[model samples]
Target: MSEKKNEGNSVSRRSFLRNGALAAAGFMIVPRHVLGRGFVAPSDRLRVAAVGVGGKGYGDITSFAEGRADIAFLCDVDKRRAAKAITTFPKAKFYTDYREMFEKERKNFDAVSVSTPDHQHAVAAMAAMQLGKHVYVQKPLTHDIYEARKLTEAAKKYKVVTQMGNQGASGDGVRQLMEWYNAGLIGDVHTVYVWTDRPVWPQGVAWPQTNATIPAELNWDLWLGTAPKKNFVDNLVPFNWRGWWDYGTGALGDMGCHLIEPPFRVLGLGYPSSVEASVGSVYVGEFNRGYFPESCPPSSHVTMKFPVKGGKEVTMHWMDGGIQPERPEELGPNEMMGDGGNGVIFVGTKGKMMCGTYGINPRLLPTSRNAEVNVPQTIARVPEGHYLQWVNAAIAGYNSKEAKSLSSPFDIAGPLTESILMGNLAIRSYDYREAKIDGKGYNYPGRYIKLLWDGPNMKITNFDPANQFVKRTYREGWSLGV
Candidate 1:
């Protein structure tokens, strides 16, 4: 994992000095002079710090490193994880605490990649943006609906470049799907069935016994951050935290953003009218147990109702924990679902379209009848790489043309996030009782409640009391804002 330097192509001293001065003056610094002739002169060579240098964070840093951007710093709560990345960029400074890292090295970096767990994503990303640094945060955007809305607002106020870590957004498949939908290929899509076998890594189950002691190289308290302090349990660290309410968003929050992106974007589906969730009781007594200490909700079924921008309505069903929709007879007998843990199934008036998790080769159903169905040829195709696109965007100061065309912006990401989060809220509401309560205290369960949304205010006109659930109170000194 030795640092790979592009020797013989190093920046000239004069060019480096000029670029440094421009950066110090808060002016843009382009890569043209540093990379010299023959190499593409990107608008700028960003100096980046990676805040979570393990798991997805490691991949993100290397991608930025490959783009010739300087890895100014690497931060992680786990020393072992941090060490693995330090070996890859030996020159980059390392720290176990990102806040401390930001405090000391904030001026040295132009951007940061936040690839931490769902819970810490908003805090880390907002901190970097507040410091006038651009950010690329991982998928699902935030742990709750309120955080997602805040991050979108913060990005606008900061006037900094921003990209969500839904790498699939940069895939050609997604772009093609958009084209198909725009062309009415799916023919007035009215329903969507999105699902995953996630926590495939086991969730909603009994917690495994902790036999191993906390590693000395790990700073467990710093890792917990604003999360209620807890002793280090072996199963909770690394990846299993996805099942706990404290660390992650269970299954729906984990995969919903990616799985539901296509349908939300293509149909222009706005806010939902209502949401309801059903889950097995394993960790807590109620579905929305008002936050817990040990675990998350068990495997659940969540249904959401979206009132489209137009008069039409759309129903989205989310099922996880080995649950799946009935296979469509339209698919050929010989055809089989590709091996993947996650995907989306769009049910339209005419037919269905299936897009896999990474936005891999999406397929249209009615295999026999639609064998000759025309699919528009894409004008632009994104290269088959995710991390590389982010790196190139960072160095160039703007996203590639293809990246801009294929990805979902805040307009789409925001509503999609809100829709998915409603599923979580629905789960909580289900816990209260079978009777659903409106703002006026009217009880109407098992029926769709017409709730009007004011996205700007993050409010529901008819459900004023429920507004508090949309956002959370940040710990003192850790709040994110303009």
Candidate 2:
């Protein structure tokens, strides 16, 4: 007890700070357990700073807080939207721009969680990663394929722990499906059908005229981030941005991670070899198609081909905007298909299996079989769940002894997200056209050709025009830097 012992033998905050010459000079100040109650071990807790603390952002940041990580800072472009989170973490320093927050609070946080609009995810997450901070980002990993590729590469180079907010990837249900599939329950899955009733917002139309005034509590310019400049429009903030190509990735982007991750994980699926799609269109008053380039089509069905698991090639079908595939024959007349609105189905050589959103309620085809069949539990269940999985992994650090297990780390999630977005590429390219060689009028060329993808190079080999979408042009001030 020669170490200037306090009455209770616990290190006080004042004592810890005064004794922190070691910490100030780069050393472990003290073990958390030895420091006693109310004192989080320097090595135990993750200091987290979150950007976009509203809507889904609120839930994401709160998960880390409740999981025992410290919420050291909060940043958001919309103050009014962020009110709930601000109230929730009153002591957290707040900023309007994530860049400013990162610049100032870089030393204060161990990790960053991003829940901004799709376009903002990569810019914020990559900036934090460049600083060597671990990150947990809301899914579809980035707004474009190029951003996804870069972030994936940076995560390894920076050596930071990472995870995506596709909580279902950490769910027991998907693992159960994997176990069942591995046990030869469903045989080799040759086709997967994932469908959703989304666009819950507007799509398949012209972008709204932007005469409406921007809300005073919202920073319109900062909120625009890497997106092209546009006048503020009502109903576009908070949620409806999902419909716009510049800001959101539409219904497919919104739900694809949850619905598609299982198939990718269970089958060890990688990039697609080809992609094709048919989209629902708005005709207005005439039978002729009304092409609204700015907004996502109301509905779409995209099919992608992937080399099968040591066998034949496989196909994955993605449907959105309330469209769904036909019910399997093994499912009874009364049995609900894929939890009603959203679901996934795998048709294999032996039989079929399926699940609902977030991979909940996984069941084999023929309702009676689910109850009768039991498979060995193989994958470890994440204690606490998805939010805590990253919290624990981050706290464990990249090289921790216990070995943090992140279900959706960027290494896995980045490629999975790229595959999901490839569906969107096909959908967007479907509308591309060229002047007819006959010199009379326009002919839809991309409409007829199947986009042959060279996954390794991230390009469409057959169509040069469709290659433009692999990356996007950022506004003058913003770029996804190395």
Candidate 3:
């Protein structure tokens, strides 16, 4: 397939001379590899600049530099968080602000690695793309629907290599799922369920009333890039932001990509036509329902409707905050369903299939069937794992054969992210309310509404107000070029 052309291109001598000319002009210099993608000398490694080089960000850059490339620059809002990366790559220049890093080291690195919070992913990646550098961004792509769409288009417009951090996309499990689907093992998967026990962070709570002092090692303003200005709250940084609307998208955003990718890849699914949701409530004291607009509910269940390749459609159910679907009777009493913490189950006409996070431990219904049934492996696997998939692709350059084979390039990640965020839109819209005409009570106008989606237009057809969530307005100084 043209989409999988990373391994099939033949290079000519003319391209080599052009590479030479670019190098002579002080462009990204590197040695040519025998694979014909780019240079391969040990000393000529692809140079990478990393933003938010801590936590998952640290793991990302470390994987990129794991004997394959040079960690040329490091940037993070909190030095305390990025401590490991700073010491790990002692020679990699460090910066508190990623804007300064890109501006100063524009020509130093051939690629950029972005592991910032969901809100900042787009701006940092776009800056790198604007400078003609390849980028590997973390999953769920962007915080808002418009940002995701913009980045997806930019990948092609700028002709840059791109990969999202949903590592399961590159795993053999999803490939196996695809092969099984191609073999008609799960015929016409009409109903599906994906559940997670996340929100390991706080949710369904009101914002802290007291303002706390900013940590000495953290740049609070830089960390809040694109997010509206807010007073520092204790324990909001490093973690726990997952529950808040401004900096995070709750448990769904944290784990949706991993659990949902199996169905998306296997069934060749696209945008959903409609989505509806019901959220778990946290009661204040014993009677009153707590209202926390800034926080995600403690639990939620979202249902989405999507039309398949045929005229028929499929229904998907997503649950989080320790909730799960009823266990199928096909398995033993003590059998595992989606590895306990997170899992996916596809209910098809013929049979059922399931997997855990990152599409791992895929199995057909009736546990013994995994070994008894065999399907041809039609899809290729990423040999070195997800992080390195981006590394190798970047070294191969934009539009090169290698870049085409990426598992979660923007083209693939964009729609997937949009679909995931659509669930959030439904969840948020579910809470839409108005002051009652009586002036003494409140009314939930959005309750019981199955929001219709116009995917191409990025809007809700029936409810006009819900469109506000589709593309958020950034703060005064923050912009996504939207």
Candidate 4:
């Protein structure tokens, strides 16, 4: 697409409403309360298809199917998963390949819920939107930074009601946190410590020891999708793929959207000025193979510096693999730190607000005041469920003020995804050099430098090679287009 064309298709409030109205006219309209209550009236039932019906995918489908949406199609590379999902929607058609599902059943679905791995999110969502189907895509919006940008562009071009799968975006807790921040409870935030105990679920301490045979039930080629082909290993299939560099974005990408989204939303954080990483590795022999490639540091500690629209700087630190910053002494003996996996602790000039992935019921505190700070009531509350919001939006079109208000379009989702991926890039760069923090006198090995960014140019002025990782070549026939 030309620069002009791409810019024109970028997300905007006006475009969102226009597309929403167009989509609403085609689908059956139901009462707003019906959708809000998680029930779909018979006439307003959305004909839906779920791509990547595994782990999270199954949960997303069940949420919709149990509600008012009709599951017309279930697609997965694994027959076991496909079969299991099929039982729930016995009448829904099933497919091993999603492209085939779209081609044959295009007319049947009013919307699609994409629950695929990171690499496949863009392709499946793009295809669905192109067909004029509404989309609810799980977060860390896209596999790579470019894809997130493109998907956001496509959502606008197609005039579809689109939502990122950061379900917490709809939560009342998250909204309250944002309101608190906006109300100056935290007072001029400058730094944040967000850590997760993730990858523990799927991230291996080390890479798989041996390549196990691929199961016959799984279509290994289709599973690889746009990533380079590799021999199928039993450990790499099903759920463990999150540790690998190709299929997943490791711990950061997996949980960044959920954990970092609140700060991003309330702060209106734009692009980062620079990023650096520190981490542990497991390279044992001549060939370097850690849990992730030595080239892609296994347990990463990344710091990103963002120069907001104004002159102020916002620095964020992210660590995975059960690592966490020292807890503030102010937290009372009864105030236990939440689970390590995917949480953010905002450090402001005055106080702090801490939250976990999905930003569920975040807590606020004063540095010295031990007791929890009383926060006032706010107007916005997180929506009931992320998936349900998208469904309602798809049916009513952008015209439903309720749906538009609850949704997080690509504009918001795209930058958040970009910020998350910065950590990944910093991890990769750490393998090459030493880095220095802005104010800290400490210098460390394998530290990535903070390169200035030009978002529109998609370039890092000081880092030439780093810019290349932002975009990747897609396998033929599977590549996305404007």
Candidate 5:
């Protein structure tokens, strides 16, 4: 495919400064004031280097480009997946290994956009921040709680603007939900129910016993990055990685950020005080329960309790794998509950409110109430949307008002991610087992227990074994570099 140019917008002079001969000449340039803020000379645009520039990554960079960002570099382990982006951004330099890209092109770009799998999010985003570049990372921020904490801290230490890829954080729906909650319309939300019909991919399945041939265009080792070394398997590349614990965080990790974020924002939630879970199991033979510790359960219902100020506690319920809470009575029998596939419900002392994923279509219960009530919009709306929010923030400099006001910066994203991953920890611990004394079968001790959490310490006070999931040891060679 031929590279297509944007209509009415020519490539900026900054592109020439960064990608043209001037950059090769090692010219040390001054700051962005030469053209002044009003004129927006091509040289003044934010230069971006995107890692994992394919799939969702490609979409991310495309948004940045559309936001007037200069896509200066593209890196992905699979050329097959990155083909479109390679053609689309022909002016951008390409690389297969991000480490090499960072080392060689660090000075060429002003910010980094990371859209890799959950496992690699922290490493790639951390590397960008370490180089003093603002970053936009996809959600659920990191694979583990520890990585989220580290990335959150790094953003402050590096003094770089940051935003997570959960675009809903910047949507008007959440702000509306927030305004209503603050107005006491819902009257002190005591509980929240967030559910999703996800795992649209397989889960609770055994790992492939046979290794398949790696794709010609892929660098298998590089794609494996921080994950444990494993033989290439069929269909694992572009998507199915979600089923396995090694690559994805199952349905909860996949949808929790979108579903849970609304409640977090509305309630000003932080780490949970305790977590408990119940998971649906897959059966093998007539009498045998299939136990694939390497995979997430086929379905699960997790409950987490958060303690707010004034000694009030709120309970949040997370349901996945097609599970959903009972329809709110206020909803008409014919009415849809949260766009049908995913939704969130906040139950308060006075009434209930709900929204679909990304907090879209938020409505107060008894549907009629939506028409009668009007809450002032106290929060600012992100008309530019999530992608541009990050780009604009980056262009505004680290300490600028825009940077400080990002909808999902690390300070918020990190803890939100950690809180969501906590449910995964409970789920994983639920599957935890030990050998029976008689050696007949394993004894599942982690099941049916509410694991007490020490959020500040990031530990399961009641279950020592579950703590292992809090911070996983990386495969050799890859490190968060904390």
Candidate 6:
């Protein structure tokens, strides 16, 4: 797309509505609520343009299609990865660059589904929202705290429907957890432990010393997107990118959204007031440490404190890379603690409750109480699931009741993602180093310090250097259009 095509068209549908263009046409648009729920005409189905249409992106568009959306456009940097989606959506137009698709096919689609790398999520979603297209972006929402906050504000400013791809937010398990908490089955939650066994890919290692040949079908430069320009490395495409800070947010970003959603909702959590972390180290030689700052650590334990009602605070612990909290004494040793691989535990004043990933298999401590505990279900469930919910909400139009009630809309997911990415900020700061005054070695001042957060302003009150991670400068030719 040319600069003119990219920079032009700043006016959005909301802007047109505000200027009374639709009113001048003498045709009033009725609200979806008045049309009755689930009553979309055959021609009124949501027309979706998908970015990164491969792997998880393929699954995302497929789910949207199953939700009664029309898959109209597909974009990806790697044709090999996108081939399946292309075959499935035989008539859908395909493009390698999302900007090209957005500029050329802007009017052909009503919504955009973004399943790109974490680093690109904010830019792509912001562009779509700028054009007044509803967006469903893959989670941790964005790669940085500033992006999360900006996207959240853009959703409201553009009057667009938005949902983060943390499907657990739509699951019945979370609602049950909320109902139980509201019923006082578990008193005010004071602590939470969310652990995941992730980074099945390599991490805590050095970057490739030698550049590899880039694949012919893959657009390596486009794949880099907002990330820094670098030589294409083998085994870095498709999935392993999750371990790198440049393109991914590590294990915490991979699983934190799913594992953290349950407690975040049940406890009504928001931005964390403070954050700190400790990371596990790997040894290369007998004495040498394998400390690749570019890659996420092999294991990390992050602690974040959030203010709750009555001026009390909730201490939340996030563990990844096979690290887990101590087992609770209320459960049998043989019994599983969160599906054996990933889980969340909430400790309340009166008792404790736990659930596996996606908030599945929620049970009170002493699992036997699950059979006896009876709490009236107050929260509604998402029977159509997450993807379809977004599809239907987008079809329902912006600011409609459906849009207002989405499980993980940016209004909620933004703060949740911001808090989750806060853990990452602390992790990256753990490696902060500066040359000592004597100039012989380095001193790590940011290490072991609890970052005092000014959430509303998006700053670290105590640590200035650590604020660098809050936002990143994109490569040339890319911008969030803040």
- Judging by lDDT against the true structure, name the best candidate: 6
lDDT of candidate 6 over 259-291, digit per residue (tens): 998999989998899998988878777655556
Off by over 4 Å in 5: 1-43, 430-443
The TM-score obtained by model 4 is 0.84
How many clashes in each candidate? Answer: 1, 1, 4, 8, 0, 0
Candidate 2 lDDT by residue in tens digits, 279-397? 88776654466556678989999999998656678899999989999999999999999999999999999999999998899999997898899887888887689998788877776
What TM-score would every model get versus the actual structure?
Answer: 0.81, 0.90, 0.90, 0.84, 0.91, 0.91
Give the better candidate number (1 or 2) by lDDT.
2
Q: What is candidate 1's CA lDDT for residue 410?
A: 48
> Candidate 2: global Cα-lDDT?
0.83
Please give the RMSD to the true structure for each candidate, in Å.
8.8, 9.3, 7.7, 7.1, 7.7, 4.4
Please list the residue runs of candidate 4 whose C-alpha ends up more than 4 Å from where it truly belongs after superposition.
1-43, 201-211, 283-296, 366-375, 430-447
Can you write out model 1's per-residue Cα lDDT over 1-482, one digit (the tens) per residue? 01122135332223322344434226445557687887754345667889888888898877777765778888898888777899988999987777667666656788888888887888788777666677888877887787888777776765566777777777777777777777776777777888788765545554455556888988887677656556677866788888876677778888888787767766777777766666654433433332222345556677777777567888888887767777777766676652345677778887788778856677777645356767667545657455666556545543445335425544456667878777765554422343443332323232234445565566656655445456655433344432
Worst 10 residues of 6 by lDDT: 1-10
Candidate 3 wrong stretches, greater than 4 Å: 1-44, 430-444
State model 6's lDDT: 0.86
- Compose the digit string of candidate 5's lDDT tens values, residues 295-332: 88899999999999889999999999999999988999
Ranking of all predicted structures according to lDDT, beginning with the best and ending with the worst: 6, 5, 2, 3, 4, 1
lDDT of 4: 0.72
User: What Cα-based lDDT does every candidate model obtain?
Assistant: 0.67, 0.83, 0.82, 0.72, 0.85, 0.86
Give the Cα-based TM-score of candidate 1 against the true structure: 0.81
Q: For model 3, how does the per-residue alpha-carbon lDDT over 25-59 read when each residue is reduced to its tens digit?
A: 24634355544655455324678899988899999
